[model samples]
Target chain A: MRAAGGDGHPGPVIELNGLTKRHGGKVAVDDVSFTASPGRVTGFLGPNGAGKSSTLRVLLGLDVPDAGTALVGGRPYRKLRNPLRTVGSLLDGGGAHGSRSGRAHLTWLAVSNGIPRSRVEEVLDLVGLADVAGRRVSTYSLGTGRRLGLAAALLGDPEVLVLDEPVNGLDPEGIRWIRRFLRAYAAEGRTVLLSSHLMGETAGTADDLVVIDAGRVVARGTVPEVVGGHASLEDAFFALTEERGR
Target chain B: MSAVAAEWRKLLSLPSALVAIGLTLVAMPALGTSTARRLAAQLDAGGDGVLGTVTTLTVGFELVPFAVLGPVVLGVVIIGSEYTRGSKDSGGGRQITTSLTAVPGRGRLLLAKAVVLAGVSAALAVVVIPATIWLAQTALGEHGHTWDALGPRVAGAVVYWMLMPLIALAVTVVTRSGIVPMVFFVVNSSFVSVTHLLTRVTPLAAYLPDMAGTRMFTAQGPVHGGLVMLAWTAGLLAVAALVFTRRDA
Candidate 1:
């Protein structure tokens, strides 16, 4: 079994302790625990319905956990003085209203969180959406939508970022842009927790890996550490799941 | 400033806001012109009691444009837009609990929504009142009515239109849909008509958001008067605030 212990590192940027979530009587996430720290992109790897979304939702406080606590900067999300500034998140590309222009949508969110209106334009440029920033979101392609989501996430200049399936519909150019942006964002001493079902997309992107299956943590370690005995990140992920018979 | 700013953006950004305002501007003039024409035709027929008929017709006609559709639709948009836009939790389905985990103080966010709705209501009043009044006066003159008698009627319509949107704003927040508030406004208006039909019931129907707001179109005394209608506006808003806090959104 993969080692079940902390990395002997400083306090993690995000800490989950025995986190569990249940919908009705079905357990979506079993007792799970892991830590995401600063200065690296910690990829939260899981297959569809593997509790990745649930875990992120729990982390962001979108859903309450049946047990355990999800913390950010050593405190719960709702208690933060300015949440958008502390932990920027991109949960779903289609979360925004289609009728609203990209800038209008972001501007409202910015205003709500006390972020300056000018930052709306800034993030749009950062995500390469400046050209179509005034276009209504309904006309955007999936890649454009992803860019808009990323722009909103960056609007706060947050200390920590939690992204779910961020690169799902991105083009090669957009993908390359995100890879570089995420790395640079982390290099600046910020915490980045990204979730993706595709191992290939994250293979070259993530420094640390946390693999989950059947709503449980199957493996957690740096990519090299976990892939020590495997050929690739995919192989390591499958080996862990097969070993657990899940 | 924060509240006003937040509310203003929300009201303006909403698709329903435009529809609501459009309905008011278009419907008022159409109805006003039609009433004026109908009255002028009656006077041309040299009907007895034409002056009294013209005076009463203008006030009664205001209901179709302002009292009924105006207030009900505005109420629905104010609160329903949030739900229609799927803005219940932070970032739409991000889960407010999660949002709370991130920002805490979920209450403040909701309060901001309320502030936006309130400001929009006032702005709607400031803009629509004068325009509606001018239209009503010009239309009545075309119907063989002098401007002197139509002035108070036009002013009343303006006041009623202004107050109606606020009430609708509150109703929508509480009900979370335009359909429910629209149904309530329409049903209540029908009830007022029913009361009048059942007994010498004062035109109390005019005092409900739709009925009473008609008085603004023409200074006819609604059943419960302006105080009662103002109470309705305040009460609906209060309920909206309460529902906003209690609900999951």
Candidate 2:
């Protein structure tokens, strides 16, 4: 089994500092700032269009911010040499061509970052996708595709992981497996930042929470601190976001 | 170097690239042989038209231009596949996300892809050009010129093939889809030769990429034509790299 951080190096922190992004003329992420520290699962909680994805996109360098900085390990993602060795990301769907098999998809990604080909099979197995690795992605069900995306994210066994809506399409068992896997991952002193609209699931998995409404942070802290007298994280989430929505 | 290997594998793994290869291999030689046979038959019937001047090199030249479609399609597929969306059940993701995450330097990634596209196009030309010429010569039999006559013309054809795909790749990068470049190239190369027709309307039309590229093998000034085509390829590629690096994935 690969140890967390792969080579025994500690996980790196993900930091977004006053990051602002505009799509057309409207603000998509407005002066957003947060940190997902090493050795913790930071749940980025928001409603749909809450700018959670926009923040993550800037963090990964998939989209440019109009102002401010998003950094991983104290450097921008685009500046990292062999970035997959430092960070792994899951966005949207499988992030694979429909005509490519799951194995083929991982194979090219591995090759690109100079990751060993052996890791391809390892990730496939880790995600319980070894059986269908040869099947084209277009044929995969929603949950299966999510597994493939997770497998790609895990291919490098990197120090940090940034995932968007990771449990959105998962079944109950898959959700349970991911919760356990992520918790154990952070337990090994690695960093994980996952975005979700599902309050209960994030509450169960995240050690810290950063809640955004529209394009700004509404609340951020440990679950207990953010929940503060709200009875539950779910109730806290609704109250925080609903208050901002008004 | 690793990025190049990855891009190469990405291209080869696409079923559309393989299909394009298969069709090019078949179509080039088939077209060469048929053209050669028709010319020979016309010569035998004592009909002097273009057939009266037919030679082995000319027969190959007649068919080689059409082979441009092969590289054009391959070039478009190289970038088009990245933007292709998956089925709704698969979350409608695009491979560009995975690609950017793997190699976050957008300029580096686009350069690697262009290198692979150029290499594949050149390799395809090396294989298909010789095969088509050999088959055409065999079909021409006694009427054909010796293979020695093809030395420079064959080189010219290879260069022409190599450059055409880069042009296609650049256009596809800007458009972010294969449909426009594929239709524009395929129709102009095969159907009516829009560039060829445009030559009658203006002298400057002779300088258009495809029209100038064709002159590399078919005209006397191979160097001049090749340079013009190269300029077009380089300019478009520069614009594409700029747009690609500056745009969001």
Candidate 3:
């Protein structure tokens, strides 16, 4: 899936073109293309087995691609001058050092990228983690861990944000906060690409959508455009997958 | 400055790094005192080595902790913790590579890790060295033997300890686990007893990392034997660095 909103280049801020990845004999993500642009929240929609994480991994340069390319700002993510500043990403909350304090985790990231230490404080406050930032991550709840992950991504004040299942285990309040936060993030001329299995949570927040099924792009367009003739986002998604399977 | 600072922060913050250093500090003095007394007793009986009984004991037990999983475990943890956080492919190596991709000079991070590991290992050795010397002298009753005479060999011992961690870190980077390399280190590297025996039959045993590294503890040496050991340590570390830079992290 591609993130939209390139800086007037007519190209996307994030792009995946004919991307194909296979693990041994089994194909994980087949040839697919999508773009996420700035000024919008582009939801990367797919079912349980739909290569959502795999595609994200490829875009983040975590997984090697057998075919095609994954790019940010018209260049590969790995080719960026300062990746943390150009693009912010939160892949897995489990990535944090459990024994290290949340503040330390962000501090290392900041220092690694030449960002100021104070940015760590700003992000911690932004994520509502300033109070408990000194505590070890091993003590954090799943929700709190996700927030710390978010803080890390925002440390660079990046131009583009990529989040995978950001609200997977958030409470209702947390979920609402993320929805508003992401929309406001994109509204400030930044790009946001989010992945989720829940169709409802995404329907309200996403302006554009890319639906994938079994490693293929089943549909892609504005929210209304994709669901134009369907009853709801779920109905539209089901219809698209059903038609693709047929 | 930032790259070094970041690497240093990572080393200091890691719990295992602290534990490893703590253990080395506590163990060295205890080991030195016990061995000093043990050696004095053995010498009084029939120990026959020109370098003295203290030297013999030091050579005999210097590599034990690493052989038993101390340094090897620390090495594996440095790389393995990244894998435990997520997919091994995207953990520490990927994170570093991604950072390097942005900077376009990936070698610095590798250098940074090596520098930090080597720095901490050496600092720990410095602390242990004096304590070991003091305890050994006290337990042996002032024989007027100075550590200054053992300077070259002591330097080599500290370097050997530092190099072991780097080699282990490289193995963990490629393998992405704390267990596999530790098992390899134990089953393969520490099978030195068998190699020691093989030396009587085969000349090739002299070049192995285990045999060659042991020569670093020699009390006073300007011989070809110590140089051969230095070469072995250099060889292993070079191979690790080459593999680390070329592979897809």
Which candidate number would show the highest lDDT if scored against the true structure?
Answer: 2
TM-score of each: 0.79, 0.96, 0.86
Superposition error at A223 for model 3 (Å): 0.8
For residues B1-249, write the lDDT of model 1, one tens digit per residue. 443464466567767667867776576556655666566566568754777634633533444443445545655665565555433222343222322333345456555555555455545654555454455555545444455865566555545555666776676766656677677566655454542343345554444555455555556574345566778877876776676555533
The candidates, ranked best first by DockQ, are 2, 3, 1
**Chain B of candidate 3 versus the native chain B: what TM-score?**
0.73
Q: Report candidate 2's interface RMSD in Å.
A: 0.7
Q: Could you give me the TM-score of model 2 versus the true structure?
A: 0.96
Lowest summed lDDT window (length 10), candidate 1 chain B? B89-98
DockQ of each: 0.22, 0.81, 0.31
Model 2: DockQ against the native? Answer: 0.81
Order of candidates by TM-score, top first?
Answer: 2, 3, 1
Residues B162-229 of candidate 3 have per-residue lDDT tens digits of 66676677777777566787667666554555556767888888665556655666643424545665
Q: Which stretches of candidate 3 lie over 4 Å from their true place?
A: A1-11, B41-72, B85-108, B183-202, B219-249
TM-score of candidate 3 against the unseen true structure: 0.86
Q: What is the interface RMSD of each candidate, in Å?
A: 5.6, 0.7, 5.2
Among incorrect, acceptable, medium and high, the docking class of model 2 is: high
Q: Across residues A1-246, which tens digit of lDDT does each residue of candidate 3 receive? A: 223322353447888999998878988899978889888889999897798888987888666788999989889876776588888888744367677798988898788788889999999999899999999877787788788878878889999999988887678999999999999999898889999889999999998898889988888888887786889999999988887664
TM-score of model 1 (CA atoms): 0.79
Which candidate number maximizes TM-score? 2
